[model samples]
Target: MKSENNYERIVQNSKKFQHSQKNEMQKRITDLLQQLTNGIHERNQIMAVSLLGAIAGHNTFLFGPPGTAKSLISRRLAYAFENPQYFEYLMNRFSTPEEVFGPVSIKALKEDRYLRKIEGYLPTADFAFLDEIWKSSPAILNNLLTIINEHIFKNGDERFNVPLKALIAASNEIPPENQGLEALYDRFIIRLLVPPIEQEENFNRLLDSKPSSDKPEISEDLKISYQELAKWREQLHKVKLSTDTLLIIKYIREELAAQFDKLSVYVSDRRWQRAAVLLKASAFCNGRKETNHSDVILLKYCLWTTPENRETVEEIVMHVIKSCGFDTDIDLAELDREKESLDKEINKELYYSQDIYDTVEMGEKKYFPVLATFKDEYYANRDKKYQLFISFNKFHSQDTFNPIDEQGNTIDNIECQFDGQGSCSLKLRGNSYHNQYTPLTFKPKIIFHKGDKKLDVNKRLIYSLSQAVSDIRKQLIDILKQVEKKYEEYQQYLQSPFATQVDIDIAVSGILDQIDKLNLRIKDCERLGSLCR
Candidate 1:
């Protein structure tokens, strides 16, 4: 069970030992985001998610046109960590490996072996940024792919582990083709589109706002240290995802394939695994033991491989989330997905146990006109004698009739068709239609009286399923309330004067929309549950 005051308890404990440690993680993160995006508005999502990704030790890519603060934001993130060895580089196709890794070692060259000097460069940086990252030559990109992924710098015959923490890469646009850059592109897990300000008010603010104070140099007192981050990064593995979140993920993957061409949006197995880590990191940093519905939103940043696929991925994720109720768990989503199959299975079972008797008379010798007997006699014997009308009373108890064929089998081939009035047409499947017989006159016999036990069983099963659905619905309602409360808190914090550096309307809107979707899903669930009856 999760403690209601987990966040407070954790913060209070951390404060006792070191107040700045736990408290400063979020504070410094928000501060850096604000400072870097001061004049910017409506892009709080990029800043917030980017900060989370950095905290989780995942690299980020900011793609947009020039003057969108990509470089500024990347630089501010480096400073957010205390005393980081920050490295910034602008790469081009002509760029040589020495420029990024380091100049060829003068001492190593004397020994007739190839090597790069490793000091005050990308090889030693705790935080680094590469502008126009895809523009780098293949040699630089290949070396970068290894360094960024494994933190190892290879020079000559020696391999040294680098001290890098997180690397931020900026791009004006994604590379048009893989061209051997697929591996490098995949390394930057958190890809974001840094579109220019959308709202007019934000644009006006950008024009009138003063340039941020000189980008602060790396300062140990203000930065989040590797030790501090390592503590939570390890905790990320323990963060659990609720069943609803998993179902939503599964549904998105399925929907993406069904609705869009596979080539347009392809997510690799490795990327999904890493993306889960990012989600876990988000929940852990938020003081939760398990991920909630809101954490699923982080996937919007992870799944999109290109700007073209970004909006579609977001819509897919959000739509899945909206279709699930706030209280939706793995069990509930499973039930929703398997509803049709469940109904079919239940109905099939009920069919086997279905009542076989047609009449209500019980424990009494009651005679009923055999439908097959009446039809056979009426067709075979009626041709000998014709009548305008025949009363059904003679075919009842007073008459001795054979309801079985000469083969000693019960007449089971009897079938009837009602024609509006208190009358019906009875005929055997193999029997030829007689022009003289307009409609058969006979009372249905009580072959054997039996209760509709299968019907009762079906009702019971449906009722039980309905109850389960109702329980899940109720849980979802409660969960919805919790999400709403959290959203309100975020809004209040955003509205506070001290924290009014950026607008999170878009972020908050996405969250609110998710909440609304939960409600819609809950309603759908209710309707589905009621269907069991």
Candidate 2:
């Protein structure tokens, strides 16, 4: 009884935890996000996700044409941090390493040492944006890979720990294939397509509004400090991936593997590790202890490799996420198999497998024979061998049948009309021999299980089957309750500062659909249970 009370207490605590309100940190983050994204039209998703990438210490890539506000979004991201050292550069083929990393130090050059003054450059900045990144030469791109991946820049013989929190890169086109830029490209895990304003109303608002500032007026209290960011990064590692999120990831990997030939999409183990960090950071920022389906929906932006396969990869991710509902910890597949096995056992024990009927043998064919009483009394006094025999099919049918001899030969001038009440009238030799002829002892077959069985069979099999169905019904009801509770908790997910409303809706809708499916399963189980009675 004490253990039962403890279990109840645990359940109540879990319910409270699930429905808890957002914390102060989450509220501040939400307000900060709104300040950063204010006056931006149709760019909420990109801006919000970019900020998330920054908070998680992941690089971002924006792919689109020149006038798509890719640079603007990157510039606005620095405003989220306090006094961030921001950097911006446009790359071309003629760009040299000295121009990007800073010109070689003249004072150090006289000492026969190669070194670069890195002040006011990419390596020293906290947030950087490189536009037209693919246009740069290999010399600049190779060093960039090192900086973005390890957060370390080597100036001559000395390596510096770069303060770069997030490096957002923008490009009009992806790097050319076989150019050996794939490694550098893979470092940017959060990839988004920054397109022009899609809706006409938003576009008109953009046309009417004045040019927005590169840095928005965010309050100092709202702006994240370096100390806070560092502390949050440490705390982000503690955010666990929930079972549902892991299941969604596994399903996505399986689906991608299945479509590898057509999609040519491959996600590396390192990339997955980085992506998991991003999801954990999202959970942390939202004041949750674990990731959920809402965070899993962000994989659509992270998994695509190129613009061509972007839609296909997004479809694969969303299809997997939408198909997988909340985790109920019950094996539905095992329940279905058990139900099937029980059905087969019930059929084997209670119902006949083949048709059952009585017939009389005549040569190679079988017929049903009946006794006839004639008005002439001549045939009635004959031996039993003179009894009328008809085909089995004709005996069961309502049609008129002719009588046959004991040798299976049809006898002419003998017509019989069955009254469908186990008796028939006969006309013998064209004379009115109106007599009632009753059929022989015959019983039709019983094949299906209509719950009519012997007492022992019902006690042994049907009772057990009904109990099993009841157990399954209980399991389904439990799952339905859990899913319904998750549906209620969706409002908390919607309050997340990182995930967009559209994404939250998709995840919530997918999980809510499971409630309907679970109710259907419970009803089917009830039906199965009723069949036993």
**Per-model TM values vs. the true structure:** 0.62, 0.80
Residue pairs with backbone overlap in model 1: 81-223, 82-223, 243-330, 322-517, 327-476
What does candidate 1's lDDT look like per residue over 1-533, in tens digits?
Answer: 12334334333433443332333334545455666555556666776777788877789989898877787777766666666688889988898988888899788888999987768789988888899988888888888889988889887899989988888999888865848888878878898888888888878877798875436544345457788888878878898986656877888889878866743787888888888888787666655666655577678788887776788888777677656533432354564566545445544543343324233222232223232333343456543222111223323233322233333344444444434443445544444454334335554433333422244455666677667667667776776777777654433222211112212233334455557666776887666564555
Point out where model 1 deviates above 4 Å: 1-32, 39-42, 214-222, 260-263, 326-533
Candidate 2 stretches greater than 4 Å from native: 1-21, 347-458, 485-491
Candidate 2 residue-wise lDDT, 1-533, digit = tens: 54354345435544554556669878888788788888888888888889989989999999999988888898888999999998899999999998889999999999999999999999999999999999999999999999987889999999979999999999979889999999988999999988888899999998999987787989989999999999999999999999998999999999999989998999999899999999998888888899987788788889999899999998888878878978777887787788778767665676554444456778777666656544444455442225767676654566876879776678775676655754555666523454333333333333343545534565766777878888888888887887778766654554566665555655655665566567777887777776677
Tell me model 2's lDDT, rounded to 2 decimals.
Answer: 0.80
Best by TM-score: 2
Q: How does candidate 1 fare on TM-score?
A: 0.62
